[model samples]
Target: MNRRRFLRSVSALTALTAVEFAPWQTMSAFAREVEDFVRGPAVKDHPLRRISPHVWMIHSPDGFPTPENQGMMCNVTFVDTAKGLVVVDSGASVQIGEMAIRQIRKTLKKPVVAIINSHYHGDHWLGNDAFAAAYPGIPIYAHAGTIREISGMQGNLWRTLMEQWTNQATVGTRVVPPNTAVDHGQELKFGDVTLRIHHYGKAHTPSDICVEVVEDKLTCVGDVAMDRRIANMDEGSYVGTLAAYAALEKNAGSTIWLPGHGLPSGQVLQWNRELFEGIYQPCEKAIKDGLSMEEAKALVLKDPRVASRAKDTKGFDSNIGKYVSLAYLEAEAAAF
Candidate 1:
């Protein structure tokens, strides 16, 4: 970026601490979008790999946002239906979404007719800006609470967060939240494919919706049960996540689980379940023993299941202590 543009982006970053909840960040100033087209550097095309019969995904190798990753932190999935492609999660920015669009054209040669955002996180839905412009009036769907949060100040907070995290590569990306609200047990049929929605209340977030392709027997779990990294529990609950996993298994019955940051597999759920049990159950035991949070962290780190995955889990060293604290607090709260 030139000096003038760099200065503007830096100025926006500086204002983040003061106006975090305020709607100070606007698309016009940051994204400079004109005529529904985003003006920014394009993310280099990432190859889309097929996970199931009709589901294909562009995998993001990086779990965290950085200038090198360009905020392409979430996997963008496409479900080929009779009408067209149904996007599972758009992406983190217009540039990344545009890259997905280019890949879609090259592989499927289909238009994105509908979009289902798994949650309200900008990394999962900010790409809606590109799709909204590319496919006018394309119905973007999400859970009602997801829609409410994104439509509220969460959109601004996430947009600014993405911009700051990616160091302005996500700049010029408009905050286009999901427009349609879907609920648990709802089914939407497109041409030949049927998507069944599942929401078990507050797994990764309060309104996270998992979309299952009935014919394929695989579900997009989003951040609810991630692979290779711990899902952020700041706005979530450990007990609730464990419960959500149980509900998903009982409802879906061993379907392949695809996450936004890792490879798709049938083992994803079990892997996360074991890892989470290792993290949360130890805290539960610690709380029962009247141990401190630091003691709980030690117990969690020593759990075989947790230790087995620590080498492979992204950000485990830096994040495990915080996760243990959340688990300890949740366990203590549940005890009372």
Candidate 2:
């Protein structure tokens, strides 16, 4: 086999072992399908995984921006609410947003009446423009804090980052903030489907919201927990994140979780809790030992336990450094 073919073969074999079957089995299949497309030809057709009769999720690869993938980094979920389609979190760029629309059209021919932005993060919301352009007056819902963050300077900063990241995939992209501000514990009724939005204080972001489809028994937890890679700790609380996941488990045990990245699973919250403790305990010791934030960061990075946690992860090589630094700061602040 040639180098590219060999790599693709390796990718396919790895997928079988990497993805858990409990949740997102079809979603994992869609991701694997993309692997085939990524290695050859420029195609706009990224496969959609059927989570249920009413819900579908498109999984993006965990790699840097490229023309093939269109910088689609997050899990873009779509729900077919008897009345119309409700998109949960748009992709990272205009191309990806457009791709999602096409896939939705091909699958269900339903109008996209609503979009739920899970947080203020660019990768989760930058594709808002595509939906706004296609369906002129669709109500985009988000947490009140998320709406404020996107409407303010955060939108521009994210646009700039997207442009740089995707090599100008932001060409036609516009900054479209959520029109409807959804508060914590609010329920959005859409015909047969009712989505319960939860904001458990500051977890991934102050604006983070997890959407639970009451009937489907599935929760789309954006950035609150990840399947394979280490989640970004740049803008959220380590302790708060654990609390949010704990509340999720308490309220909805074994209900499938669709993470912001990676394959969906029932065990993600547990993995995230383990990841948080791994970082927190080591950094707390460094801080108690009179080490400065920078020193603590360095020591935490060198810890064998932390290093092993991310050894086999596909992406977030840089996030490990940022996570260690953030853990130090969080530990320092907790010292009070």
Candidate 3:
């Protein structure tokens, strides 16, 4: 099947599912519209935005993926240290990464000392080539498993489908491996700055790391605490996600939190903790109750807190649903 046809079929199925099972009749109309928009042609470019001093937010503008079909957005952070600039998580594509590099060079002439991949996700690491090409021999850091995961995957049906559904161009398949790997907790020193890398295993991915810049009191939490919505767990464990969020809350010091996406929040640590406890926990509970995926989705829909965020919640459902499904799948696996 071709990409366009497959996307159209997926969009149709999503609309049908929403119409059939969505409890609120009012939601069906909006859901159908969202589904169509997601399967439509891609937008031109997602311009980068500077959210804080030495911190920029690289949004996909395409948004996150959903069952009804929506684009995915990833966050990248650029930190200016005394030694050189350190970038946290490259954007979705090489172009986006190049665009971000251009923005970084506008202010700072220091070479990119390092590139950190928060996890193994393509959105975070696919742009490594762009940066690597620009700054030759700059060290790239990631967890050991992350390097393995990216290197192991082969271009196949999934990649083709993703390109079609997300409107991403078909770039060559070249794996970007990390030179440095962090275990549980490792401290990296850059000039007078100290970045503590903490591995919160299997949260958003098998090899997620939260980078804390000690001198700046800034934490570039890759995807642990997304500002716009819940963290994506398509390839993670719910127990791990909970543990990771708890770890982030427990260890996140009184400092500015720079999430991979969304605005930096002063109360990010606490707000993210609350977001998990208030939103995800209940969704997990609903799944545990043997609610069908559709039913579980309805439960999330009813929550005013989740619903309030649902206004901008087109592509977010897929990530949330994936998390819910993973939680249930993990429970099932544990039962066996």
**Candidate topping TM-score:** 1
Model 3 — which ten-residue stretch has the worst lDDT? 62-71
lDDT, residue 89, model 2: 94
- RMSD (Cα, Å) of candidate 3? 13.1
lDDT of each: 0.88, 0.80, 0.65
User: Alpha carbon lDDT of residue 39, candidate 3?
Assistant: 36
- The C-alpha stretches of model 1 lying farther than 4 A from their native spots are 1-39
Report the lDDT tens digits of candidate 1 across residue range 165-225. Answer: 8777887888898989999999999989989999999878899999999889999999998
How does model 2 fare in lDDT?
0.80
User: On a 0 to 1 TM-score scale, where does candidate 1 land against the true structure?
Assistant: 0.90
Q: Write the per-residue lDDT of candidate 2 for residues 1-336, one digit (tens) a residue.
A: 555456556766666655655258775766756444433322266789988657799987663455445577788999889889899999876667888899988877889999999999888998888899899999999999999999999998988787666555454567899999997778999999988888899988887999888788888998998877776767899989989988887765436888888888777777777777878878899888987767776776666656666776656476776787888889889998
For model 3, what is the C-alpha lDDT against the true structure?
A: 0.65
**Per-residue lDDT for 90-133 in model 3, tens only?**
76555556666776676555688899988876667766767888
Worst 10 contiguous positions by lDDT, candidate 2: 34-43
Task: Name the best candidate (by lDDT).
Answer: 1
Q: Which stretches of candidate 2 lie over 4 Å from their true place?
A: 1-43, 63-68, 292-307
